[model samples]
Target: MKRLVKGFAVSLLGLSMLVGCTTQAPGTGDKAAGDKKEQITVGLAISTQSNPFFVTLKEGAEKAAQENNIKLVTVDAQDDPAKQISGIEDLIQRQVDVILVNPTDSAAVVSAIKSANHANIPVITVDRSAEGGEVVSHVASDNVEGGRMAAKYLLEKIGKQGNIVELEGIPGSSAARERGKGFHEIIDKEKGVKVVAKQPADFDRAKGMSVMENILQGNKDIKAVFAHNDEMALGALKAIQAAGLKDVVVVGFDATDDAVAAVKEGRMSATVAQKPELIGKQAVELAKKVANGEKVEKNVPVELELIKK
Candidate 1:
């Protein structure tokens, strides 16, 4: 009985050693603090999910995170700059490896980006850019070029010599600013083309309809309408139809699903098509690179196309 007891104790000690060794092996649970991270955490601060365009962007990001075995924390700003700031603050508190921000307002989001900078966290802008920040990368479509496409198509439709109304996006947004700049660069050169009115609808479909209604009420001679986004374009379309206006060319940007459907059904004349999903995917891909201390470009522009009926 004494010999058996001693042997059992020796076997127990050997089994413990084997278990300890297994745990200490490289790539096992007992990795040291400095080992390369097995999984990365990414925080996505989206502007608003209410817009279908943004929803698609979020889905793309989520998909990429899954494929890469990354953990993603998402917060929706609901189009409020203040909310975006708070959400980013939360992300910082969570100690996420990287942040992907879609600013509600270019200038208003500067402070949020600055906070991330102070936290030593890399920030990558998606879709819209911040006016001031230490962003490692910016992924988006060239809004200026997209605007040029929309303007050229609308002008051709209206014969390049007509009074047109411009439905601008939320004031101070980078998309709104750049798109407007590209549009004016072309429309300003044409003496025959005149902008009868330009109004900001805050990128809201309901507001777009109301603003268009007001403009339509005031200007019967307006020959065409150009909205900065598909939502606004659809709103303007409803107003135009309600007012029984015809022969007025309508063009919009951001070829969202509904907008594409409208174009196919001939409700909209044309739209500048942007791949929101591709933009989101590219942003995440860059985010992973940035988190891993990889070098990337400052500005990554996704391709844009024009969709017509």
Candidate 2:
């Protein structure tokens, strides 16, 4: 009977040892189910998923976040400033460790950015920047430079002298403002190039098409076109085609897959390429640095290039 009792105690001891080994404490760097305890949570508020650029940007951020073991929470603003503000407020309510925002409207986003500031949350702007509030870092390409590049390439294709139509992006966004600034900086200096039409398409494809259709009705002598983004460029292309107008040099920014394919097919003259994936990955890395109280550059720029056939 003593031997039987002793065997039972031995079995109990073995069972206890197994439990101790398997059910270790939550955060000892164990590859356990609750390993997220060691992760820093990051909140990503994107402008819109309707645009492919933001979609690719989100994928890059997610990839980097996963590689770094960061817990990421994403909210889409659907290109509405009010929705963006409310979404950011939700992120703040969640008390995320850091915030990466791709603002819909630079001016309108200031209120939401200020809210994040009030909550003591560090914010890092991705792609588009806010006009007001404090931001720890901003990650993007040199949009002004890209604008100049696109303009220069378009001028080269059109022989540097023509009546051109400019398709603008969202009015209040920094990208639209900066790219326009850069484009006019060069085009304004050239006396031979006349701007026949200038209008905003809100950086949307369908809007681009409709706006171009309207512009084409009045100004059919357009020699070249520069769109702030590829979506608009593609839309404008559709309008130009539907109107049976051929040989208009259509240049776009953001070398999205569709834009690149268009360029290859000789439909689009060229496009300025910005590495959105790199921007996203870098933004997450910078956010991690900010969370750990590590120093980082205030403005981080990704490279931009011109893509043509």
Q: How well does candidate 2 match the true structure in TM-score terms?
A: 0.88
TM-score of each: 0.90, 0.88
Model 2 lDDT tens row, 1-309: 999999999999999999988786665535655333468999999999999999999999999999999989999999999999999999999999899999999999999999999999999999998898999999999999998898888878888888999999999999999999889988888888999999999999999999999999988988999999999999999999999998999999989999999999999999999988899999999999898888999999999999999
Off by over 4 Å in 1: 1-34
Error of 1 at 48 (Å): 0.6
Model 2, residue 199: C-alpha shift (Å): 0.5
Error of 2 at 300 (Å): 0.5
Return the top candidate by lDDT. Answer: 2
Residue-wise C-alpha lDDT for candidate 1, range 181-285, written one tens digit per residue? 889888888889999999999777999899999998888787899899888989999999999988888888888898999999988898898899999888888
> How many clashes in candidate 1?
0
Give Cα distance to truth, residue 236, candidate 2, Å: 0.1
